[model samples]
Target: MKLKQLILFCILIHIVSFTNALLRRCFQCRSRGELGSCKDPFRFNATEVEDEHGLATTPCASGWCGKVIEGGGTYSADDFDMAIQRMCVQRGPDDNEDRCAYTVYNSRKVFMCFCQGDLCNAGSSFTASKSMFVILTSLLYLYSRWNQY
Candidate 1:
């Protein structure tokens, strides 16, 4: 009947809207000029506040989940410092995408990455880049060897 069809359509719409309302999540933590899981070579240990994989996450209802790394100071000396922050960022329109941006101010260097989807702001992106670098380097080495013959 028409009534049944209308009700079914309304139910479907409600389900889709509900799914869309579900917010994305990302690791939420911070560390400043000190050593911790939130710092370089980030390795978060298992804790009750973290997920099963030991990642501390928070809901990102607006904008995108973001990870920020800031470091500065003389690398050859003991004054080197670093900071890291992971959280939901609500900024301009461009903050809604999956991209990494780097900026430098004075002696400080900052690297910030924004990403959509649940838990997409994790450190996997760094690992992926490293893997790609290895693959590309190997390919270039092989190409040079082949052309040498």
Candidate 2:
């Protein structure tokens, strides 16, 4: 019946939407200037880099994008090095999440910030909204599928 077909179609659409959101991964990179969009030759395998900085790849499943800053001071000495890390965050800017905690060690204040879009944490300002991109892409995909049938 048409009712059964409609239910199945609705389920299929939901599955596609959920899958797209889950698969939306952020690029793992450190930047001195500003982080670019996670396009190009990079694909999401979620690989961690082995280094003293202890940076890791992150997925934006929970909520927003995050940036971790360590050693926000002078870098004149040979041992002085600044590290910037980007990851998928679970909470927003005002949320009291575990990952958003700030701690200081050895006169270094470890700071964190959150943004609500893909690659939006590249800098202080968000270039584009990830949700917009997702909605647009999804619409196009659904439109193409409709045309096919």
Candidate 3:
């Protein structure tokens, strides 16, 4: 009777641990940033202005051209424009010295955006590892139980 109870308890513990791990993975994947962090790159301030030459073809011209602040990563006209539309000042355009000009802001906020992107990528790998761990653990547990019987 004691052996039977012990087996049941072990099984229950394994189930609980596996379930908790799965829940964590699900929550991490659904969260905004990745791995329990904020993914937003910038706090945009919108400004309305009228273009005198009617040459405001890009949205960033009059709406919100991300405040070039210190600490933010480098910025190119293209990626900067896209980030502006997304209300995020995180993304920067590809580096090109000859054609497009780029500026690197010395701001923590800008750096944070780059850091967040890195974290997001790391989180994806972490989640994958968690999945594999769970599968292997479950298989090992089952195999052990069968061998014991």
Provide the overall lDDT of each model, using Cα atoms, as 2-decimal numbers: 0.60, 0.53, 0.32
Give TM per candidate. Answer: 0.52, 0.41, 0.24
By TM-score: ranked, best first: 1, 2, 3
Pairs with steric clashes in candidate 1:
none
lDDT of 3 by residue, 54-140 (tens): 112122211112222222234643332222111222333444111222344443233211111211222233333465578668767
Off by over 4 Å in 3: 1-38, 41-71, 74-125
Name the best candidate (by lDDT).
Answer: 1
List of clashing residue pairs for candidate 2: none
Instruction: Write candidate 1's Cα lDDT for 1-149 as tens digits.
Output: 56655665575567545544553566787776654456655555324445443247777777377788776545634313567777787652453446778865336678887776555565655432354457556655755575566
Candidate 1 displacement at residue 73 in angstroms: 6.3
Better of 1 and 3 by lDDT: 1
Worst 10 residues of 3 by lDDT: 24-33
- Better by TM-score, candidate 3 or 1: 1
Candidate 2 residue-wise lDDT, 1-149, digit = tens: 56655765786688667755664444466644233323222222333333324334456775477666675455545322545666775556555332445766348687776555444554523234455467657766875676576
Q: Compute the lDDT of residue 121 as modeled in candidate 3.
A: 23
Model 1: residues with Cα > 4 Å off, grouped in runs:
1-19, 32-34, 40-48, 51-55, 72-80, 92-96, 104-109, 125-149
Report the backbone clash tally of model 1. 0
Q: Which should have the higher TM-score, number 1 or number 2?
A: 1
